[model samples]
Target: MNESLNELLYRSFDTTLSDEEQQRLDEGLKQSEGLRQEYDRLKTMRRIMAEQPQPDFMPGFADRVLQRLEDGGDASGDAQLFFEALWLSFRRMGTVALLLLIAAISYNIGSSDNVSLRSAFNIPETTMEEIIEPDFYQELESLR
Candidate 1:
């Protein structure tokens, strides 16, 4: 069976080709010199990349990671301590902010005067008194 182009290239490197195939490849290579040059460049780049060394890191990276684990990190096992601290601070401040807002609104609404609800709106004092007190309203209902 005839081999695929990739299989033919793989066999060309790690194994010996049959004399017929070798002659055929040589004729093709002679016809396209650019292909042969590109193949050589790719082979050299692959070899160089495989041989390249990894970069070194700071010495304390592992120690800092272990320290974070001891401090109770989350599921991802990293950044848990920092995130938890930030979340707690925000939660506490948010609760305080809501409480302050509630207190301010309560004070303002309780103390503010509305003309529509006052005697100045042309309502009599008796009507204003009934509007201000539930006991007065109950008495008026019983009289009626």
Candidate 2:
């Protein structure tokens, strides 16, 4: 129940006591039979735990867990599946948009007047004097 005894007990478990702390704990253990008994019990428990064989896992344990996640067995897998679904939906929407664009273009072309391919390439003839008028050149000279 004493604060120092409690601290010493915890320090003993941590194995981080200085010489003075060790001496204090030793003195307390000598003075209190209950503290001594508790210390012994803790030591025995520590020893037992240390002596026990570590549990062995099945082969490819990590690989199996990763595989399960990939197969949509865990939260991460669910997230992956969610992203995949989102991607598929986006792809479908994109395809629909492309088809709509193509349809619109086709409709516009079909509805337009039938102009000959040669007529599209025919540029209207214009004289340079007509393009740049004498009046326009006079305005430029005035600005200068």
Candidate 3:
């Protein structure tokens, strides 16, 4: 298709074309078989569309659309609804994670001699070599 006259060809169907544009479109159709087929297809489509009756909208179409627009305008509301739905879906997993955290904290506190929050989480000061040695577990077991 010739880019220069393609727009002119489509325009000739909807609006009156100038003599110069019509001549250019005619010359293009004569030069390109493909363009001529496209022109024929457009003409057939326009004729078919013109023959069909215009479709009517359902009753209350405007009211329904306006109601939807009014109800769906809040972005924050939509986000909050999505978050609430997500929380509902994963509440069981959240419960399990919370239980596990509490159990871990309780175990740490019970294992500490001091029974204080600081002792429950504190790491004993030790050289890196002692932590890596095989005897570390044996020494820790003996202390217990």
TM-score of each: 0.37, 0.42, 0.38
Candidate 3: stretches off by over 4 Å: 57-144
Better of 1 and 2 by lDDT: 2
Once superposed on the true structure, which residue ranges of model 2 sit more than 4 Å away at CA?
Answer: 59-144
**lDDT (tens digit, per residue) of candidate 1 on 1-144:** 123433455567768999987776666566666657655876897799889999878999989788868867454544767788889999999999999876766665566564344423333446655566888777877898
Q: For model 3, what is the C-alpha lDDT against the true structure?
A: 0.82
Model 2 TM-score, all chains together: 0.42
- Top-scoring candidate (TM-score): 2
lDDT of 2 by residue, 28-62 (tens): 88888888888888889999999999897999999
The whole-model lDDT of each prediction reads: 0.68, 0.78, 0.82
- Candidate 3 has a TM-score of 0.38
RMSD of 3: 13.2
Q: Which of candidates 1 and 3 reaches a greater TM-score?
A: 3
RMSD to the true structure for each prediction, in A, is 11.3, 17.5, 13.2
lDDT of 3 by residue, 1-144 (tens): 777777888898889988888888888999999888889999999999889998889999999778868888565677889999999879978999889878887888888777676665565757655767768866767787
